[model samples]
Target: MPDAMKILLFLLTICLGSIIMQPSVAQTVVNKPSAATADTVTVRGRVTDAQTKQGLPGVTVLVKGTALGVSTDTNGFYKLVVPSIRAVLTFNSVGYATVERKLDAKATGARVVNVALHPDTKALQEVVVTGGSPSQALMGSVSGVQSQAAHDRKQKRGGVSVQIQGISSMPRAPWYGRSESYATIQENSFHTARKEPLSTFSIDVDAASYSNVRRFLNDGQRPPRDAVRIEEMINYFTYDYPQPAANEPFSVTTELATCPWNPKHQLLQVGLQGKKVETSNLPAANLVFLVDVSGSMSGPDRLPLVQSALRLLVKVLRPQDRVSLVVYAGAAGVVLEPTPGTRRADILDAIDRLQAGGSTAGGEGLRLAYSTARKYFNKEGNNRVILATDGDFNVGEQSDAAMERLITEERESGVFLTVLGVGEGNLQDKKMELLADKGNGNYAYLDNLDEARRVLVRQFGGTLFTIAKDVKLQLEFNPARVQQYRLIGYENRALADEDFNNDRKDAGELGAGHTVTALYEIVPVGAPPVVDPLKYQANPAVAPASATADVMTVKLRYKEPQGSTSRLLERALRGTATPIVQASENLRFAAAVAQFGMLLRQSDYRGSATFETTAKLAEGARGKDAEGYRAEFVRLVKTAEAARRPTEDPESYGVR
Candidate 1:
């Protein structure tokens, strides 16, 4: 063997080793960590509307030329860790122009960079008009069409002038896609306590309406009239009610005061506070996550938010809990089989892998979820199907009646439902509310990640565990003390007098740590009669008990979460009416919320209620708000007030 040849081979091997050891160009471009890499710098700031100067939530902030990104919180605040001080950050959000900010290359330590984004008028102007004639197209471009037939008729009138006139006369589309639907709510009217002595209704704990209204107000749009469920809005905020007694499931508190909106009338606030149970003491849970990955849910606020939300839930799950993931798009299928919550990583990984596309088969998804829950039914534990969707059921039994029937049947299996509605424009709120009510569960609307955290993390026990079911309230107003009374809100929850005592009748459920409230506007015997004295019938005689100081008798019926038979609870409220200024924070806050709802709904009985009055009331009643939710509510009232004012420059008003 020649020594020269061996030496040459050795040199070639050394060259190959050197080449392999050197980092690739792509890795260097991506700023891969290395011994010489600079320490990470923390970047934090807020994104705001340029005109309104208000925080812009749900904005996406990203490191330029990299995959690293984070969304702003509810207040448009974001914090990100960058590999180097020289990194450039980009801010993007719906309806707003994108922005880019570059950090100082020589700067060290944490950096703060606030950004303001302007509304994108071009993006706002974009609309979809399908299968329309040239004249109809012109009309659509001028003023959005309400229906095809109406536009066609306007087109037949002929001439550009006529077409323009018709366009001006045409009504604007309720929404671009016109897909959102809300149940029509007829405001409760005053009823003479003499003729109708009993007021009965199912207790409601659902707060979807409040968040949904916030979404609309934040976008600088007035929510639809039907979307304002006064009862839900009133109950969205938690009241500082005392805990139940050791032997009871909940505590009842009642306050009577002069109505804020009407000094002539009295306001009666009835609150029930459920016992708070520690998470450690909660029963083991068998949860089926029924996620909608339909095309409509492809928006950032939909499927992606749902994924993030479920991830938060998974982090809090215990070893005794079991989780299953089921997703629906064009079809429904199980993505992950029943697995113990101890395997958090596995559940999270499955959730991360979810992507959105295809039509929504919500009905099929519900059916599949319930079946999966039944298959692994936890007899002694909590069994629930958590459905997260936009509630657009386009395929396979989409009717509300059909969905009610399906949920009603499945609820008999002892598996409760939790419907989390997300997204906008095409949100079928009516359907989701109905499904939740029929399934003997609660409904919530998640508008942002902060809300997701609040629902799945902050209020874990209350959101997932039920303490009472079939809860109903009945009040008998003393004819002698009261002439007419109106039940505020609860229009849809009103139950027939007989239904209150009927055990077979389904009603609202109370979650652990939940608080339910109801309000009544009463007219004293001396107040002007709401109705003319009966034309043909004589006034009924008041009972002997009605002569007492008691103004009304309150009765409640509820059943144990797992029990079929119901138990009765009763209390009496005396005729003493406190001044509005001296009312309890609970009563004042609730009255404020009720007034807010009435103003939003433009209720016939709103009286002197205004946005200013509502905000003032809320501001005074926001006592020791630990979560800052009460503060947020005050801001929302201001936003609503600003939105209601006429403005020439919509952009200045922050119209999204």
Candidate 2:
């Protein structure tokens, strides 16, 4: 057997064995609970829908006035550790009236709080009443306006909406549909070094696109072509770049290797590693959570998910940090004042009590959130607003241009933004990205609890703290060594060549410990060009490139978070291309991701790329695989492959 296959099989065996042993470990009996105390109690129950008498899953059962809570499983079963028997348990779920039950576990040796919740008329009205289909019913229950808005957006963009399988328990609806919005992408064509020597663009630290793609793949659907941003997909995983030393905000690394899918082309990788600062050493934070309580957010995966996700972020807060809550529905208002991080319970309770209803006043919400942040703005602290929503903005400053202006004006106050998107169907992805881009912040999409933890907890510093802003990269290739080059991705982040040195031109922000990677597919000196050799070009190409042995000169410009002016750094790429197998794990893995994205989008330039090839490349480059992110990525790739597989019956393609 081949060595690589043998190693893969060995790893598979170890992983499967571990999975098999988990149940046994879980089944191990525990010592008898310490004598039941008056202060502590265990409560178990099953909740159901009052009308259907069917079990309700994902219902939040919380100890009233406290942060303690647990969600019911698929079987509507729940077990919670209550701090006291005198506490009241509150059951909350979208479209249902809140239910509260006072429990005294001591009085009843084994207390059971089985309750059925009734639907709220207002929430029910949010659903469009159409000929009943399981998918229609489920989707309708979420937001009528959202569906309409999606339809309008799709129609406006000269695209058609597509019907997708509803969540579990919903029958497919012929009329039910979902719409995705992405900024149109115009692939960068190869540029001859002699004709166009410099390639410049802004940096992108957002990984929302990757997680959003995962959500689609996990749901057994292929992501829309526009939704696949290759740059974001590659940046989602961290690269092993050297940390910046003294007097530098970041370090730069470069690698050249043969392209995996197209061996004829050479790949160049440029990576920037932001300086890492311990969370404790970072400045105190003044955070304002701007939550969307619009009717569209009324779903198990929307408001409830946001609440749960924010709790994880709260757990990481230091005592020096302060958080405020601002919720928007019909209007925006502050729910909680600036509360110290030490009072975590208070912050969590405020988050928990947020119920979804009413129209979305996104503009008003932004105004209020910025006002709140400004009121508590600490010059030395990390002041920012975190907007959690489905990106559905209906009321007030609704146009993309208007929203952009609002965010732009607000960012001048030195406060950053963090847009966390949740839910689907009518996701305003473009609007959210625009807001984040203009607000001088980052954007992330939360598809599930795991993603929530990955963003809000594991990458807390990078997601929240901005170390540098307006970062841009400009690469000048040597015509003597290179013929043509094309950037692999970052279509939407492209900037004018002059913008590289213009500090007034806004760009992207870099957070502490964050790393950004960009790739270029280069055609060496004699390679064919995409454009016809201009017969007698306006300025005949002159290749007097110096004998410095440099392939390209890289210039980076960025401003300190608080500085108005930018600083410049330069590096040069020199030497022949490295073999793929001998390339650094970071380069190989990122190349694999870019290949996967191109294949997913069915890009014409993805020469000979296949999912199988991408997966194999990634498997070999899964360095350390800490936190199992790379492993999860492998599983996601396989899931996408399965989803894209052709069935035996051609008619059954893309059908459940």
Off by over 4 Å in 2: 1-176, 536-548, 644-656
lDDT tens digits by residue: candidate 1, 489-509:
998899999999899999999
Candidate 2 per-residue lDDT over residues 1-656, each given as its tens digit: 99999999999999999888775633553433434333677789998767545566556676665434666665568887776777887776544567789986458455778988875422211222334333323222121112233334334544322221112332211111465567888777788888799999999999999988876665455677778899999999999999997899899999899888878778999999999989999999999999999999877568766876887798899999999999999999999999999998788657756778899999999999999999999999899999999989999999899999999999999999999999887888999999999999999998765577678877888999999999999999988878889998899999999898898899999999999999999887655555677667584654535545799999999999989999999999888888899999999999999988998888988998888888889989988754546765765675576563312332344223
Q: What TM-score does model 1 achieve against the real structure?
A: 0.81
The top-ranked prediction according to TM-score is 1
Error of 1 at 58 (Å): 9.0
Worst 10 residues of 1 by lDDT: 159-168
Please provide TM-scores, in order, for all candidate models, with all chains considered together.
Answer: 0.81, 0.74
